[model samples]
Target chain A: MTRVRMDLFVSLDGYTTSDPTPDDPMGPDWGRLTAAYTATRTFRERIFGDTSGAGTTGVDDTYAAAFFEGIGSEIMGAGMFGLHTFPDDPDWKGWWGDRPPFGTPVYVLTRTAPRPSISMDGGTTFHFRNAAIGDVLAEATDAAGGQDVRVGGGIGTALEFLRADLVDDLHLMVAPIVLGRGLRLWDGVPALDRSHTVTTEVAESGTIHVTFTREQHA
Target chain B: MTRVRMDLFVSLDGYTTSDPTPDDPMGPDWGRLTAAYTATRTFRERIFGDTSGAGTTGVDDTYAAAFFEGIGSEIMGAGMFGLHTFPDDPDWKGWWGDRPPFGTPVYVLTRTAPRPSISMDGGTTFHFRNAAIGDVLAEATDAAGGQDVRVGGGIGTALEFLRADLVDDLHLMVAPIVLGRGLRLWDGVPALDRSHTVTTEVAESGTIHVTFTREQHA
Candidate 1:
């Protein structure tokens, strides 16, 4: 029983990301949006390789740890894969450095011509695909080997799967901020609680974790 | 200290209200947005006058109880008072019954000509005023007699006070649902945590209770 999972960080007002600059490609508000998640011990261990364990340990850390678990394959947009940032850089890999946090086969959905797969130092491999969402998901599912196929989003790609009803679990980390700009994640989606079992928890740092698990899948 | 407090119910997607009709003046999504708050024990006791104690008592009920406490006077928009629904009906006295919940001076902000104040059965008086937000707030404060002056909102009227930096405490009941439409309350407001002590707690009904208390006021 393979499940499609997605994790998104957004402001309380529903803004995902804001204006991007040369230094911060993800956007200026992206840091504020992801402050709680990044302030977790698990994030320091998995993302920054801080083995000293010098970060907040609570619900936020638990979610951060769960984010990297049970994900056997990944599906992300070209933006998440740094294609939008470094479009012409043939030598460019991704923002995740030589060894990305994902230790699985990652399918980067792009509209450009297909490029050869790139295997990193870790157990992660990036496969560029110029195909439809369903086709790409099928490939990602096959690569998952019955595990969860995680959607590594930049919001646009995640929304495509969500609007198409392909996601089984949608977890949103809402920071206590009023980001006046950027796109809302749940713009055209149906009320989640109607079809899914919605659960919410507040982290010690004031980040609200809301998860909508599909009732059928649950 | 006479703090200017406000309580708002909105979807997790930030929509305060959706397409309204003659039947549901607040909107179709109003019920969905306010389900958790309305289901609280305090709401059942205060709003509906249900003395049987037949409602959930949790973090939501605590907040619902606080909503009516210390609010000596309130200022609300004309829409919230059902002015838009019944323009010509001189006898229109709002959705709340003869004994309205707030036993205080309720100032109805409207552009129409001021009418004689309607004093309800249970200490509730509707004073129609067509003045600036500050002026009405000042009048409401004076009527409060050193107690807290609450901004009873329908989004439009609430934003006026919020934008004008008149509110010292803002509490939002964020239901775990996507409305997808209507107006966002914090569209242009700065990040709350920057100037206020923002706290979040999850109610048993999955409704996230976020309170932004002004640090200066605190």
Candidate 2:
């Protein structure tokens, strides 16, 4: 089955980010916040294109490797695709320089007008959509070709998918820091325990990897 | 040196408890939320006074037992002492019927009048105080007699101590549930990572025991 999975790097206080700025890119605390995730060998090899093969090979690395495995398509919001920062810039492909990490067909949910799809160097291609979550998920699921569809987040898009009960699996990497104020991931999702079978795995980096899979009913 | 510590049973979304009503004392999901904690032998013997010696002894029980050890005095908000639930009732000792677990001097932070202290059947003694966090902490510290002073919580109280930077050590038991709306524990607490070093341990009960300790500065 083509599952709808989400991977989020969240703070201990439940914030995804502190709001992006032009100077800070993802936000002021972006570097320190994603330290554990970026230190993984999988992140180095897959996301950063660090072909030198230098990175930590721990539990976090294992999860990082699995994050890129079997994911044929991705769905993300405009903010995640850098549209929030470069709304007026037509040439702005994404934050992921020349070689974007996502080698799958990526769908960007935005309110912008329909534009031609941007094909990156890798197998990745950007397709913009301004439709309901169901419609977008359907398109992304079909594009997945029986593989899993990874719902990339900036909190807003993740909340929308989770609120609509559209996510099959959710992997939340809880960083040790507390962001205090920002876009909280669990805003509208009430009583999530009743819906999912929850589990927690602690990494050597002190990140608590909590996974929630929707329960199957009889 | 004896450190002031805290132990909180919190939801995955960082909520301590939902709005408590008479119908739902610890909110609607209280039972499922603290199931593992309350099921421990330490909780059974100390809290429920169950002498039958029937309870699971595991990693969760290890933390549960540690929660009771190395604590001389306790500090909590009026709500945690059940003063909010039974505010008008002059005879309300606490939610713990007869033998309250806290054998140490338990100071309840409230704005009520200066009344005589209530000494329970156990070593627990309830004293009311309307002073500030500094004053109360000082009083509790003195009463601790070189032992640790536990800052017990109901979210609001814990936040007050945390915001004031009075807590030396904090242990948060992350339960696998989300109560979407409630008094959040992390509100107003920004850049907590700058002060504390955090670590996490996962139990068989699926609870993520996260600890934050103030880093010693030379």
Model 2 clashing residue pairs (backbone): none
The digit string of per-residue lDDT tens for model 2 on A2-41 reads 8899988889988888876644446776776688899998
Q: Write the per-residue lDDT of candidate 1 for residues A37-140, one digit (tens) a residue.
A: 99999999888999997999999998988898899899999888888878888777888889998989999999987788999988999999999999999999
Pairing residues by index, what is the TM-score of model 2? 0.93
> Residue-wise lDDT of candidate 2 within B1-218, one digit each (tens)?
65789888889987877887644446776776688898888889877779899876887899899999989899998878887787788888988777888888999999887657999977889999999988998899899998999999767788888888888888888887778877677888756677888878888888888888887621
Docking class of 1: medium
Which residue ranges in model 2 land beyond 4 Å of their true spot? A22-25, A215-218, B22-25, B215-218
Q: What would you estimate as the lDDT of candidate 2?
A: 0.84
TM-score of chain A of 2: 0.93
lDDT of 1 by residue, B131-204 (tens): 98888888898999989999987788888877777788999988888776777777777666667777899998
- In candidate 2 the C-alpha lDDT for residue A84 amounts to 77
Clashing pairs in 1: none
| Clash count per candidate | 0, 0
Model 1 alpha-carbon miss at residue A113, Å? 2.7
